[model samples]
Target: MKFRMAKKSDLKEIVRLLADDELGSKREKYEDPLPEAYYNAFSAIENQGGNQILLVIKDEIIIGCLQLTIIPGLARLGIKRAQIEGVRVDQNYRGQKIGEALFREAITIAKSEGCGLVQLTTDKERKDVFRFYEKLGFTSTHEGMKLILN
Candidate 1:
């Protein structure tokens, strides 16, 4: 698998991967005339300095993707941390350790960026994902809460 930054052209495939699962099927709209919101959001991220959308390509096709945002804060001794989100692997590529490789590459990138910590939040209902993250050395030391503005 090859790891690289995502491009605008990769959006369709990325959306397909994201919408392949049950949760994403309800949340993501994968249809003809792809939504403008997706492109707008991608452009925003592209213009942001400390944010990135990464892609994992296999055999010249995108198979997985994730978003990473490096946040600078006064806490933790003014260190920067990387927040990972939107992690997804192609349904056809699940159980192939691609997710593991993706995480490892993300960590490496975070470290290179001088991130003191790498953190992410998964849906509480995803028990299996929790285990997967734990196995990857993440700890559930604090509760995560979110409110949708829209």
Candidate 2:
């Protein structure tokens, strides 16, 4: 498998991956229906900017996707941090380490860009998912709170 920055053309596949049951439930619950805004946000990031959305491809097929945002921070002072989000592997490809490969590739990209740290948030109800993040070397450092605005 090869990791590459996503293109606008990949939006459909990305959304399909996101819509899978394991990943889409909460997002669907809130959004009820997915909107073009979500796709637009991802496409903007996937373009050549400080932010990036990457895809794992094998044999010209998109197998997974992850978004990385490089934040220029005052706290880090010339340092940046990467916020990784929407990591999802194709339902058929789970348990094959494709997700890990995608994450490691993102980490490499972040490091090359001088990111001081990489951060991500996962739902607390998914205990197994939390353990997976822990196994991947992420610590539960902060509580995440959100206020959704329609």
Candidate 3:
């Protein structure tokens, strides 16, 4: 598998991967006519510094993708940390350690950016993903909560 930074044209494939799963299918729209909001959001991410969308390709096809955002904060002794989001691997490629490779690359990128930590939040419904993360050495040190608006 080849991992690289995602381009604007890769958004469709990325969205497909995001929507392929059970939870994502309900939250993400993978329709014939793609939404303008997706492009708008992609553009926003592209224009932002310290933010990256990564794609994992095999045989010239996109099979996995994730987003990493490096945040500078006053906490952790003024350290910068990388927040990982939207991690997805194609269903056909599951249990092959592709997700592990994605996280390794993210960690490499984060360290290169001088980040001291990498963090992410997964839905409570994703028990398997929780175990996967734990196997990756992530500890459940804090409770994550979110409030949706609109």
For each candidate in the order shown, give its overall lDDT on alpha carbons: 0.93, 0.82, 0.94
What TM-score goes with each of the models? Answer: 0.98, 0.87, 0.98
Between candidates 2 and 3, the lDDT winner: 3
Cα RMSD for candidates in order:
0.7, 2.9, 0.7
Give per-residue CA lDDT, model 2, range 1-150, as digits (tens): 898887777777887787776548646423434577866676667564678778999989999998888888889567799999888888899899898888899999999988999999886665677877887899999999989897
Off by over 4 Å in 3: none
TM-score for predicted model 1 compared with the true structure: 0.98
Q: What are the clashing pairs of model 1?
A: none
Model 3 lDDT per residue over 31-112, tens place: 8778999999999999999998998999999999999999999997999989999999999999999999999999899999
**What's the true lDDT of residue 109 in model 2?**
91
The runs of at least 3 residues in candidate 1 whose Cα sits more than 4 Å from the true structure, single-residue gaps closed, are none
What are the runs in model 2 whose C-alpha is more than 4 Å off? 26-35, 46-48
Q: Which ten residues in a row have the lowest lDDT in candidate 3?
A: 29-38
Backbone clash count, each prediction separately:
0, 0, 0
Candidate achieving higher lDDT, 1 or 3: 3
Kindly report which residue pairs in candidate 2 clash with one another.
none
Clashing pairs in 3: none
